[model samples]
Target chain A: MARYSILVTSSPFTSNGGANALAYCQQLVRDNHTIDQVFFYQDGVFHANAFMHPPSDEPNSVKQWVAFHEQTNTPLVVCITAAARRGVLSQQEAEELGYNAYNLLPPFSQTGLSDFFTKLHDSDNLVQF
Target chain B: MATITVRMTTPPYQGISAQDGLDFAMAATNYGHEVQILFEGEGVAQLAGQLTPPTGMKSHTKRLKALPFFDIEELYYCTQSAQARLTDGQSLAVAAEPLSADGVKELMNSSDHIVTF
Candidate 1:
């Protein structure tokens, strides 16, 4: 099975890219393919925002991503530069930046682009959305 | 190290995709991977010569010109896309080769990984 590294570069609500990436990941899991990582960059960092609250009936893309991570044990990495620029900060990052609050959700860690390249080097394929 | 191709389809300055794609390409090269950048669709605008960004906008042309310094020498643009968008007398700022559809297919097929922006 091919190893895949996924890149999400669009906002979760503004576009369906995040949801579509999740579906692709699910299909990969069903096919027994290995997922090396799901790297979020640019506006895609919004996928890890813990403060997002949609209507109860609406689909929560962040929650769905977290669930996918749980099911597949795949790493969800958000680019720290992009996340910080968009206010999607982890507790440590918020503290470092002197923000009183942080919104980066669990199961999603903030990292540099170097980490993404390292993972991409190890993967057989890279899929972007 | 892997041979990676980053295919850009977004126009420059309008969104962060163009900048992000260039940044990713540089980062990949820094990590000792082979990187090729392909500009297609609206992305071909990124290589247009004599681009002048509005006040407060970063100069994409300058950044693109510095790609060779980062050791990313393989640059390609879709010939059809450029012909459709660029009027007569317009030219590319960077020294990128024009690729037909088949050439683009070969580039993607030969790369170990393909990333689109």
Candidate 2:
């Protein structure tokens, strides 16, 4: 199985961009490939929110991602800068937002943009959304 | 010794870029080349079981399922994207992962060449 790292830089609901990112990773898993990591940046950071509740008419994107991580045991990393900029704060986000600290959590870890490059260096393939 | 990676950025029922990427990857495998496909951005819809293509367009979701038979084993989707769509692991017909951006970069580094559509 090939190891892959995918980067998503689009909004969760804007233009259905996030949906496309999910397809790439799922197809790899179907082929018995390994997903090394997923980094959510830019507006993509909103994806880490578990509190998101979309209407019945609209599908819940955040929930779908949470389940995907739970099943694959793959790590999801959100950029601190992006999260803060977008106002996506975990419990730590309160402090970060107040003191300007970075707070990202489980299923969604906090990291630097440089980490994205590091992961890319180690992956068999890398794709950006 | 040669590994090819295909990146998808279009959503289902919106455009043919994702389907074209998948089809091209399959064709590469058929041509005796190694291939890997990654769906980023809106391209994740190619795996959405709820997809309903408009008239005249083909079903990309079905075409994507045929990758394994062609030995196009490496398929990847952005984890954040999946979360955005509310698509779970079980929801996908194939075995898949929620790949992180970092992982995707590394995967690209391993490839000899990459293509995005």
Candidate 3:
């Protein structure tokens, strides 16, 4: 199976880009392709927000992603610069920065955008949705 | 040696996506990849030469001008969308090329990878 790396750059709350990326990722895995990782950049960091509480009946794209990672053991990395600017902090970052709350939870970690370039090289396909 | 295409689908002035797309394309060049920047859809507006942001706002023109210095000269805007701007008397950023629908198709078909913002 070819490896796939998906880059999601829009907030899950603001647009369908995050959901779209997830669906694409699912299709890739369903086709017997392997996912190297999901690199979240720009507003896409919102997908990592642990505190996200979607209203009832709304598709919880964030949890859907978490479940995907849980199923396939694929790694998810959020762009550090973009996540920080938007206040999508990991628990450690929130404690260090003295923020009242933190959102980045399990199944998602942080990395620089440059690190993604290397990951891209290792992947058979890189799709940004 | 990989041919990477970064396609921006939104205008730079509207949000950070366009700027971030440019940044990644530049990063690809830094990594020695053959990077091509393609502006599509509303992204075509990002290549307009008449962009003049109010004082204190980032000047996209300045950032675009720096792309050539990075040896990333393969810049193009969709010809299908060009009519939207040409009909309004707008022109692309200096030296930015036009990519016909077929050319865009060719790039996607040939590139090792495609990333859109």
Q: What is the lDDT of residue A64 in candidate 3?
A: 90
lDDT string for model 3 (B1-117, tens) is: 578988888887776777788788888787777888888998888877777876676888788989988879988889888787556657567576788999999878888988888
lDDT of 1 by residue, B1-117 (tens): 899899989888886889888898999999889999999999998888787887787899999988998999999999999988877667779889989999999999999888888
Residue-wise lDDT of candidate 1 within A1-129, one digit each (tens)?
A: 999989998898789999899999999999999999999998999999999999999998889999988887899999999999888999999999899999996799988999998877788888888
Quote the lDDT for B107 in model 1.
93
Q: Candidate 3 lDDT, tens digit per residue, A1-129?
A: 898878888777678888889888888889999888899988888888877888878887778988999888889999888998898998888888999888888889988867887777778888777
Better of 1 and 2 by lDDT: 1
Score residue A53 of candidate 1 by CA lDDT.
93
Poorest lDDT segment (10 consecutive residues) of candidate 3 chain B = B85-94
Among all windows of ten consecutive residues in candidate 2 chain A, which has the lowest summed lDDT? A96-105
C-alpha positional error of residue B46 in candidate 3 after TM-score superposition, expressed in Å: 1.9
Indicate the TM-score of model 3.
0.88
**What stretches of model 1 exceed 4 Å from their correct place?**
none
The lDDT of each candidate is 0.90, 0.73, 0.83
Winner by DockQ between candidate 2 and candidate 1:
1
**What DockQ do the predictions score, one after another?**
0.78, 0.03, 0.57
